[model samples]
Target: MSLDLAWRLLKGGGRKGLLSTWLTLGAVAVSTALLLFAVAVNFAFTARGERGAWRNPVPAASGAVAVEAARFDYVGDKEITVVDLAALKGDAPAPPGLPRFPAPGEVWLSPALAELAGELPADQLAGRYPDPKGVLGDEALVHPGELVAVVGHKADSPVMTAARSQDWIVGKGPVEVASLAGTPSEDSEAYRALTLVASVLMVVPLLVFGGAAARLTVARRDQRLAALRLIGATPGQVVRMTVAEAVIVALAGALLGAAVYAAAAPLLAGIAIGGGPWFVSDVLPGPLVLAVVLVAVPLLVGLSAVAGLRRVVVSPLGVAKRETPPAMRFVRVLALLAALAVFPLLSRGSSVGIVAVALGLAFLCVNLAGPWVVGLIGRVTAGTARKPARLLAGRRLVDDPRAAWRTVSGVALTGFVAGFLGLLSPSAFGDGQESAQLRIAAPVEQAEAVAGQARDRLREAGVTATVRVSKEERGQNRLVAVALGSHAGTPTVDRARTALAGLVPGHTPTTQADDQRFGLQLLADVRVGTIVVLSVSFLVAVASSGITAMSSILDRRQTYGLLRLAGTPLEVLDRARRAETLIPLSVMGGGAILTGVFCALPFMAGGVSTAGLVTLVTCVVAGFAGVIGAGALSRPLLRSVTADPAPRPD
Candidate 1:
């Protein structure tokens, strides 16, 4: 009976309720799309990393063609990775318009590499590759960041046999596809773990937003449910009715989200992972993952609704009269301190995976206690409010602190993530060069002149350093120089770099600690990953901010009308609404950021980079600004609600 009544009520919801339902649906859909896309991208990256592992021993349809795959740092600096042409082929047959196999020493470069190297073949006159006329052709590649060239070799050649094979089998393979899933390398494991944590942080708030959307007009719902209580409906019956409504809405929203994800798959497939754009076929989750998401979202939504509606279930009179909720205590602030203590311990000896998991746990604790902290902040704000608008907003928050917090908690949490990510990515290679060894690579003919110019530049820029020609690799000559105290940026390194760029054909002077380009690329990758998640979180925050604020205004129509009747100008009420949104936003966001910085402190012992800190603050500010804009957009609703005073029943 309760379920039937719930469905009837839902179908009869007026236009406003219908609109809220759609907003809820969109929030859930967006969240679902993000989660599935994250999973798909992870799978794609892992598959590409394990590219050769599967095709190494494949079944033969009679006999299958096999090709070798070898990856090398094209320029010794790891600026880009180059694979032999056969590497991209996997177990596939020879591609049309290309040689079935190249004679020994022939190679193909990716367009990006060819562009960087001025279309030169693998061998002649470039920094590396060691041979000229060895370059065969160029091809566009996809799926990873910088796999830039492919050297080809004849089938069954001695060199080819020694190399690993990665051709996706065109014919049947001896090994089962299912058996080829290998454990990822430690690096990949750590990366995926971090990515998963970011995804969790992003999705959690969306889930919260969707729940809020479903229960939009909570005050109205509470009033109605209380009347149901007054009329002798059992508490269990009322609870079931509310849960049923939330579950049905959530289930519908989750399905809509799955559709949203499917529609967004093509866009996601284009994201670069290993060395190229992911194959579209690799960008969808398996059935198991889909099933879990679909089943779990509704159950989670239902439970949250039950928890939120407890006030109505317990006492009809209390809810109907708009009783104030219990004030939150200061203990909620301890979660941040606890997290601060854990981070230092984590920095000392924990693995990246463990650290990420612990960080996630700490975030959860903060989120759970966020409302309490927000409530305590309300008391502070009320005590401090001097302006009429500020005082009224503070009083509203004091009346229902959880409701106030929900308006901006999404923004607050994003700030928290931003802070955590700020110091989280230092040189993956570690800090302090210990020795500022500048590695110089130039043509054999220009080696001495380049070394001389490098030394002269260094001398001109600052204090002392020594320069020496290092060694020859292939056709290029090399030199190494050691400089004093430059793990921190130095003008000498900058000047030397300028001199080298003028001398070397492709000016890339590297450092000993900088080693290969891997560290820089890895840092870029980490930032990109964080940005992707943060962007989505920001969008969720803004959308929920507007929708929930509008819902709250509609639910509080009578209260606002009474305030107007009591001679509060609409302008003052409007300012109060803005204050209500911005106060918790600024306070909680600031706390969240502080908590994030505390979490990041141990690893950034030398202190956070000025650039990093500035970037994070800018991002957090931009996010809050967006939320504030959303709140502003909902002002018309407030005007409409408070336009006329409605008499209350005695």
Candidate 2:
């Protein structure tokens, strides 16, 4: 009986109620889709990590099946992962992505590398390896376009024991491996941590938006539910009816959202991170995660809907008389303060898990304090009002701060995200060494001999350069340097690198950019990630502000109508509406930004960079513009509601 009544009411709310229902559904859809996309990033990184782990072989103490060594090689600017392997026993299992262990003089390249090799000249790239005997399988590569080569060599090859100048640069020397199973690389782990952090930044805002969906059209729903109570509907009946209505709409929305994400997964695979774009499979949160989202979103929405009924359930008479609820407590602000205080203390050198928890708590605390700050702003606005619109706006704020907060909360939280990432975004490192220098590491005893070879190679290649052997603190060996002339550039660098490729046995010749390539790539990725995070945050902010603004008008249509009938000008009502959002948004948005900056301070080793300052200012300007634009878009709705002053059954 309750379910039947719920259905009737849901279908009978006329056009405005129907519009509210569709708006709520759309909000849920947006929230669910964004949530899935955010979660997919962590999973994608994990997949990439696992796929590439076999390259970092774990040594076996005894009964070893194969000997393996891996190093990074470059063609132009592209990085190629080269793995050399030799079999100790006939039954040695092939490393991942091969039909069988390669025979001596045989080389296998990934599909991408094979294609690349065909396009480049033999001396530049393909000549570095034996002619390709086969293409590597997907299991041997991290992403679809990864460059990898597996070359079979004699066990006694000099490459096996060549000195690895740096573990990160030259890769580890050959080790006897029993199995291909290995752990994720340090770079992979770092990326995973970063993706997780990005998820939290995105997901928290998505959740807050989702919860706000349940409260859409609260005033009208509360009135109808309260009247039912006043006419003898049991509390259980009311609760059941509310749950049925909210959960059903939410479930439909959740399913639609999951479909949207699934459809967009192929497109999302193109977002480059950690060296390359993703495989389609990597970007999908699997069926288990999909099931969880479909179930959990509706449950959350239902609970939030029920929680908003305290007034309707506890005091129907008061709701009927349209009395204001008590102001939110100051404790909410303290909660935010406490969260901000704890973050810096826990941030430095703490594990990723700890930092994540602190950030999550801080993110949620921003949401918690937003309404209380809005209430305070309302009180101040009302006390200082000097005009009709100001008085109306102030009265609205004091009357229902939570509603006003909902309209601006997305922007406030985005401000927090912007400030946090903006402060940590990296700037370009100093430009050092004007001349291009190519270098290779050699044993201290062999340094002079390698230096002699380097000079000869550069001369034969017609490259203008000076050669020297120098010792750096980072390595135990001496480095043979080929310092090129002022006019030397990419083609000269490549020729020089190829000429000296085998000069040092294990270590490849490296340019200054190659020496610092990993660090530079990491910095570049951070900047890209910052842009992505901020872009998504702004989108959510705009959607929430716009949708909630329109919903607020729908929720308060009767009030706007009454005001119009009482001779309030349309211009005054519109000004009041804008002031209601603008006042609290300024206060809460600024506060959230400060809180975010405070949280990020512990990581600011050299203080804020110029790029960071620019990001902050840009976010502030964009955020204000987005919110104000959302308000402007809803002005027509405001005008429409006031155009008809008479009340309807809905």
- For lDDT, the strongest prediction is 2
Tens-place lDDT per residue, model 2, 1-650, is 88888889989988888989988998899899998888878888998899888888888988888888888877677788888888888888877899999877799999999998888766567767647999998888898899998988777777776657775777865888887776788889999988888889999999999999999989989989989999998888989999999998899899898889889989888888788888899989999988998898999999999999888889987887788888788898899888888875764587888778888989888898888888878889999999999889988998999999999999899999988889897655634332378778888888898888888877887767899987663477877778887687666777777778778766777777776677777877898888888888888888899999999999899999988888999999999999999999898889889888888888776678888889889999999999999999999989888878997664
Global CA lDDT computed for model 1:
0.63
TM-score of each: 0.74, 0.97
Least well predicted 10-residue stretch by lDDT in candidate 1: 163-172
lDDT (C-alpha) at residue 306 in model 2: 96
Flag clash pairs in model 2: none
- Candidate 2 off by > 4 Å: 428-435, 459-464
User: How much is the lDDT of residue 107 in candidate 1?
Assistant: 52
